[model samples]
Target: MSEIPDAQPFTPVSDVGEFGLIDKMKAALADAADARDLVAGIGDDAAVYRVGAAGSDGPSRVHVITTDALVEGVHFDRTYVPLRALGWKAIAVNVSDVAAMNARPRFATVALGLPNNLSVEGAEALYTGMAQACERYGLAVVGGDVTASARLTLSVTVVGEAEERAVVYRRGAQPGDLLCVTGDLGSAAAGLRVLLAGKDRMTAGDGAADDPPQPDLTGFAYAVERQLMPQARLDRIEAWAEAGVRPSSLIDVSDGLASEAHHLSQAGTVGAVIDAGLLPVHVQTALAAQRFDERAEAFVLYGGEDYELLFTIPEAEASKLSPDTYAVVGQVVEPKEGVALRLPDGNRVPLEAAGFRHV
Candidate 1:
């Protein structure tokens, strides 16, 4: 006897919207692994969890928590980015947030919604990459939930701890504080250009005609790596404490320099003047931008997702820190004049919110 096949044809997930897909996912995650720490998981206004010992001496170590969500077609494209890089990035971005707070990340939980198209092996590959990241950063993968969905979505929540005094905030910069940043900027934006160009070349019928030259990734690789697997500047946070140089204000440059400068200014109730020439530009980043016929200075100013730390220090106290590590790029001014950039050609340009906007 010949067995009859199912009558209905398989349909691609695009037919259903995000909510329908989420509902389907909830059902699949009905049976969750048992654990004592997870007070609540899934199906709630918010998931709750307990931490620390029942009774402990010393001020309850400050608990730092952050969450980030990456949606396919928005945060990443499957064609250009590998599953491993995707997993690493998913955790790196959240770790960057923890670093910005000057905290030590200890644990994380990941929740993933995958499409039918991805194989079980592909999903495991992603986990392997995330596990590698956990090993590198000294964080434990405490828990997570996985389910099927129409599109790929990854959300990670990282928990960290810090001493009360060591934690830095964005609202502390005062008048006359020197503005500084660790590492160079704009390379990530240039790397994005390279990746997009590569995609264009592959998509066009002419694989050779007018094809852009192989991206010279010398400096650009750092930026590409920053975008793929950025290291949170936790070491710098520890160094600053060791040097007794407490930042008056601090922010991570996930957005462009101008935008972060504006953030510091607004939060601290002060204005700032940044010297364009003083802005750090790595040699490779400059060369990569030149190759693409783009202005490196503009990329440094307006390019986003560099993930370096932007901080302010009192001028007198700043001298105590090692000169080899930090640069004095600007200074805080009275709130009368908004954020301005002093150009190399002896002109001043007003700064605006030109960073990456999710919405």
Candidate 2:
């Protein structure tokens, strides 16, 4: 064989503007495999899908719906996030919203805007991740739209169904209700710190000439995994219903516990007092935060993306809940008092709103 000339190294994606990148992405995914349930896919004003008729049990089953958007650079970093994780995250976040409403997610429509820099193979990898999430959650990607855009963007709308009288909302809490949440908080935030530090180390090229040991990432890995593939609390919601436990109010911790507590307080026209000592912080989360020189307590209070359910139950019925699945974090008080954090030392402090925001 003849000798071949060497080609120049590939440039990074940042060289191209956002819109130009999207155009390249569109061209790459031009031949997506056909999906039968997709009435529309990858190019339309909105995707359309068909849902089966309501069962004969009652009036047409009520549809529970929610939408969430993930933007490159804002919600995720293309460099560190594997394509599969990215796809899973896009769907998982939407599913969490549906679970927050105490509904079973059944269908989802994913709309994507691609930049030209991404290859068809890369897009397929992303779809593979999304498909895995759908299977895991018992949801179907019934339809979606694909289009060229300035940047990589994934917008997902999930449709769910719940019995007419079973859907929960955020505005129903009353005074004397017991506030609760599923799972521990702060792991995702701790994971983010580890990721950032790892990125910095890699960029700095501070490794030994021989072979430096890889950084310990166990704690961060769990946190990052939680952020990437958070499971919806649908199982717990169903169990609560079966046990005859109805929440007086409900909301999800898309934001941190502190912010969500304020949300429930404002919506229900009541104040809340959360015991700081009772806030759940996973061991991994605490360790990760310590490695990053961050306060573990602060992370639990204000670090977002836990996605656990925050709800209220009548004081009398709170005892019926299984402690393994839920924790009584606080109590509802009259509105004029405002939300507060009762300290371990028997002092109280005003609860400030702290959580993630796009802008």
Candidate 3:
């Protein structure tokens, strides 16, 4: 007798989404889980572990590891993105995860796949950007791999070290804590809009979101630059330590404020209320928004790639943080209240995680 034919075609990964895919993978491997030394696994920014007598400082030391990848057609485009900036961005993304853990980045290993079109100079420019990032973030590039591929890809793995107690987790937010963010939001998204518009004009009015053009980038210079070369707020991480302020919970805003805030609150089993008026938007972001005939606030809440820190702290410590360093944009509320956002005109609504999607 013939066997039954397949019941259905394979499901598209997009349907599950990035985080959903991660959960599926973790669950598939859950049976082999070893939890003794694993402080955190697949759910957060980085993996945290209890390091033993290895870090010079002995048992109190904890280790964190995070990896990030940038691909030509997926994570970036060749049209307006500079190779150097892309390199810096790849490093910044991984380092941002380390910062989320409130850990000091110590070392990184890069594995890059180069296309035939990239010249020695192009490769050098990319490495230079990564070098700058490493120096700025106090990290060393110990080793890496270089390979040839049809498309360019850069994968960076970062290792960070910190005292076990100093490491922040996304699950520690308390109901009375204040919601905080470092630096401004929405600038990068504005810049991406400018680039896309320029490309469309170059393609003779086709608005397809691919291809390249050396578009006049002065429309919103700062916003465009932010899209290409964003910083990872490492200095602010240092300052938080300097002030002796340990955030009750922490995350980096790579996906966008809305998505990140939801992630943090859900992980912590709490809720948040974001004040729309309290979000700090850069001047260039506003200008870019007007040029595109869009609301500036949209980018602030939903634009991804700001790479800023989203955290929560006790009200007492929150009061001590300077406004220049931290913006208390909201407060953790009871889980019964749910995650909500307060608009400028005094309307409150559910905080939706409707931001950039990687899948």
lDDT of each: 0.76, 0.77, 0.87
Candidate 1 to native Cα RMSD, angstroms: 9.4
In Å, residue 272's CA in model 3 sits off its true spot by 0.6
Candidate 3, residues 154-246: lDDT per residue as tens digits? 999999989888999888898989999998999999999988887766777456556544476775888888888988888877887888889
Encode model 2's per-residue lDDT on 1-359: one tens digit a residue: 97787988897766764434755765677577454433323321122332446355544345667778888988888767778888988887887777776777899999999989878888898899899989988899999899987778999999877665666677678889998999988887777777777777665666554554344575466787776667667778788887887787787887788888887886448999999888888888888877777898777788888888899889777777776989889899999778989999989898887576543
TM-score rank, highest first?
3, 2, 1
Query: Per-candidate TM vs. native?
Result: 0.79, 0.81, 0.92
Q: Candidate 3: misplaced stretches above 4 Å?
A: 1-4, 7-9, 54-59, 205-214
Off by over 4 Å in 2: 1-60, 206-215
In order, how many clashes per candidate?
0, 12, 0
Number of the candidate with higher TM-score, 1 or 3: 3
Model 2 residue 312 lDDT?
Answer: 88
Error of 1 at 245 (Å): 2.8
lDDT of model 3, residue 99: 94
The lowest-lDDT stretch of 10 consecutive residues in candidate 3 is 205-214
Number of the top-ranking candidate, with lDDT as the measure: 3
Model 1: lDDT to the true structure = 0.76
Q: Which predicted model would earn the best TM-score?
A: 3
